[model samples]
Target: MTTSMTKHALVVRGGWTGHQPVETTDSFLPFLKEHGYDVRVEDETTVYTETEYMADVAVVVQTNTMNTIAGDELSGLVAAVANGTGLAGWHGGIADSYRNSSEYLQLIGGQFATHPAKAPRDELPDDGTDCFVRHTIDIVPERADHPIVAGISDFELTTEQYWVLSDAYNDVLATTTIAARDFDPWHRPITCPAIWTRQWGDGRIFVSTPGHDLGVLNDKNVRTIIERGILWASR
Candidate 1:
């Protein structure tokens, strides 16, 4: 079938509302609709294992964080996506969930390593303030031509910049430097990859490290990056 044909998408959202999980999922619904996907929203993670789950679905969008699923169920998901399904998620939903499951990490290609919960660098003051943080994103020419990020221009954010442990299999798409400051000590500077895509068998996967809050998505640059990722990863 052609990529333009109607496709099915499953959206599983809701976990540790600190991430504003539901709102993020809600905001992304229209994007899917605009791209010709028949979307299904699940409030819990169990729907992934229903006997009649849409194995033929073109894409699975996960907005869940800090949740665990049984080994069998997680394996079922890995198998489905490996055999030609597509999986896409952003921020903690994809990288922070299933912290204890090694298999889950193998499929997703990364894990949330750490974040400055209370760091000395007050640039991102923890004083209950709301604003966007600006940083420069470096795009890898290797994936600059990929459909997901083709038209996306480098941008900045005012949210928690995620530090991830990514596998070598990942196709690094973009990155932002995490320089050392008073709150962070470093003799040299370091850079973190902010977005990436990977392949598993006939399946495809995409992940972005931004989107810590609804306000974070308010930036048009961040919104467009995620919107394109969903369409690019969908089978």
Candidate 2:
């Protein structure tokens, strides 16, 4: 097909049920359509093998939970994104996924280590979890002006604060405080990158670690950041 007939985006979703891949992926469809992207949704792992899968697609939106992609299938995805196709995902969908694949980690540029999911269900406040619990997402001053975070503030979310051990190859956009937790054996405070972007050849890769549940994604503030990240990561 020609470019005019394309400009579509492929949303591959399916993995663990905890992340509610289907529900969350559905919530994002309209936004892509609003942005002029023809969206195609899939729940199968085989979609990766289709020769034209990435050829006519501007972006690949992955909402899978913990599924693995290996061999040439995985390589195809990396090559596509490296050659100008965009890859965008959030939370476990991207960072915490495919634990055993080095190539996958190299492609996405991050891996999820631990997420502090304590407190009562919805105990954290909206303004800021200032319990020292206070979540202050410090924006990288140089990257503060990025489109994905253009009008966003240093807001807070009471969701699962992901503690990631990411590749230094990323351009970190924002980070939250370093706090000591009993669960972490190291017992040292560590600053976590909440949002980051990386380049794969001629393409773009975007990831955010705040979406631990559907409610988190439904929040206006969280929703906006995710929406912008999707657009920013699209080819």
Candidate 3:
């Protein structure tokens, strides 16, 4: 039961199942509980429309991908954050979600443009794992002292390296490079934000592009970064 001493967290997760929204979100319930949050778990965004509950929520941990959000739902979410509700999410769950909603993109500060896969002998990977290229997630030297990534060092992960379309508004904490393979259309290497945070009104927004699956989420650095990100985003 929620009490005055407990912080409310609304976990809205649903959309493309391929992202493993349920399994992934489920992995963090214990962390949130340990942090004193009385979590309300749902697979819908309508919870955002419940003004009273929205008001009580200190943070929203979302994991919906490619789903459309209604105007009222989006508005309520925006209003709650503007009034000091934090938001945090990872990978397509946050970045690739609500592609039709420009307002949502503006809020997130970036969108998933593509993930270049390893060049094939003849053609590209017709199956899914091609995009799982080995890459290093480099921590930004200047921002290493930031609380979320404070003792973390640069690490490598064999997973999707997001080539994100990002704006300058985000305070990027970490980055990863997209290899400029000969077969790839992009000529030069590109660096994309692997982790970042944004200040929205009185609220905080946290994002990490590394959570491609359970394996990635369970990685020491990735898992630690996410746990810290959630705490840092909370009001």
Scored by lDDT, the top model is 3
For all candidates in order, the CA lDDT equals 0.78, 0.79, 0.90
C-alpha RMSD in Å of predicted model 1 compared with the true structure: 3.0
Please write out the lDDT profile of model 3 over residues 206-228, one tens digit for every residue: 99999988999999999999999
Q: Is candidate 1 or candidate 3 better by lDDT?
A: 3
Cα error, candidate 1, residue 118 (Å): 7.9
After superposing candidate 3, which stretches have Cα over 4 Å from the reference? 1-4, 121-127
Query: Is candidate 2 or 3 superior in TM-score?
Result: 3
What would you estimate as the lDDT of candidate 2? 0.79
Q: In candidate 1, what are the lDDT values of residues 33-65, reduced to their tens digit?
A: 988888899887676676345566788899789
Candidate 2 residues lying further than 4 Å off, grouped into runs, are 1-5, 117-134, 182-184
Per-residue lDDT value at 203 in model 3? 85
Question: Which ten contiguous residues of candidate 2 have the minimum total lDDT?
Answer: 125-134
TM-score of 2: 0.88
Better of 1 and 2 by lDDT: 2
